[model samples]
Target: MDDLVLLRREFDAEEGTFLGGLRPDLVWDKAAFSRLEQAMRRVCAAFAGRDELPRWLVEGFWFCADWVPSWTGHADFPRPEPLEYYEGAVERLRDLQSWFVTGESPYLEHHEWPAI
Candidate 1:
């Protein structure tokens, strides 16, 4: 399967925590995390220049950056940093990506565990 496809599936399956929700033993290493970040950047770049973004990008891809620090408490994996692009729509995407990678959501004052 394509890396992006697998990533999208993982992002969706894990509800934006990436591998953070998995067992500690199943957590990904630094290299895998880097690849995931690259994949996310590619997706962000693809839509960043567009005047209007699609619903999937806003509802799905953009939300993939919803990270939870507590989710990684049991794992020692390295976390991804936010991409450096801050132009136009990409800025929002990068902010969301930052939230996922760094547990700092620009839209919220605090990080809370999602209610189940």
Candidate 2:
């Protein structure tokens, strides 16, 4: 499947509002957040084990992570807040994309690693 198509399937219009367009005051309801988190997890899983991801996928994940911190809470996993997971996902995707670009096994910088 195409990367953009996969991203679109994970993050649909009805799921959660786009982070790039989200306002600071906007509060997604429980269901909306559930949809968003589910999609994020699915996207993450889809990209797992890949040495490199497409540029579009990295951009999409970055866009979603941009607004994760604004959410109130989640219904599914909660180890890394929604925003945190998305942010890390973006870095992971970027590492993969970088691998494609530079032919390196380890692409992430020290700062790119998620803080524990």
Candidate 3:
């Protein structure tokens, strides 16, 4: 098994908090979230069932930066609603790219993995 490195460090709380602030409405930005979600699904499918996936990439996508309350069934965050799940997906993918690749090639190009 190979170690899956993170592309970059996690966003500091300030950065994450700032990002959470950008979408203040309880309603999600569906279009933008869809695009980000599709991209992340592709990435995750590419590594599906692989234990090499790092904790941050997995947890960030599933739980998101703002979904803590649902998992805990409490209003854990200071926000009125959960932060956009797909935003966290995008952040995770970006970090994954930096972790494993170089240059201008697409992320899948870095590995010999088959098309998902």
Candidate 4:
């Protein structure tokens, strides 16, 4: 299967949406997160050489990658608040694309996670 197809399957659009700021229907477990991460990585690798990437792909990948760790940190299972927790993932993805194309990594702040 195509990497993009795999990623899209892993990140089901209907399930990804929040209902009244919560996603109770989705499985928020380690196995689910691991599968998402793997699918995202495969998509990233497949698109590394491309001049442009799909916006949904970048946004979905970053939404999970950036928020999952913080969501896991909460003792009482709190839903991830996008307004409060959103890191600039699109920009980071752009930097990653540049690095793949130019073989140069940009300087990152200590707390910033690399897009790849």
Q: Order of all candidates by lDDT, from best down to worst?
A: 4, 2, 1, 3
- What are the candidates' C-alpha RMSDs? 11.4, 8.9, 11.0, 8.1
Q: TM-score-based ranking, best first?
A: 4, 1, 2, 3
Writing each residue's lDDT as its tens digit, candidate 3 over 35-69 gives 44345445555665454666565555444433522
Q: Which has the higher lDDT value, candidate number 1 or candidate number 2?
A: 2
lDDT of 1 by residue, 2-114 (tens): 65575666556553344544444544344444555556555554544455654544555444433333344234544343223212223444564654444434554544422
Reference-based lDDT, residue 25, model 4? 48
Give candidate 3's error at residue 61 in angstroms: 2.1
Model 3's TM-score against the true structure: 0.37
Q: How far is candidate 2 from the true structure (C-alpha RMSD, Å)?
A: 8.9
Please provide the root mean square deviation of candidate 4 (C-alpha atoms, Å).
8.1
Return whichever of 1 and 4 wins on TM-score: 4
Position 72, candidate 1: lDDT: 41
The sequence of per-residue lDDT tens digits that candidate 2 reaches over residues 1-116 is 44445456544443344432233434434444444444544455466666777776566555455435434233442333466654554454444444434444353333343331
Off by over 4 Å in 4: 13-22, 25-27, 78-116
Which is the better candidate, 2 or 4, if ranked by lDDT? 4
| Residue 65 displacement in candidate 1 (angstroms) | 3.1
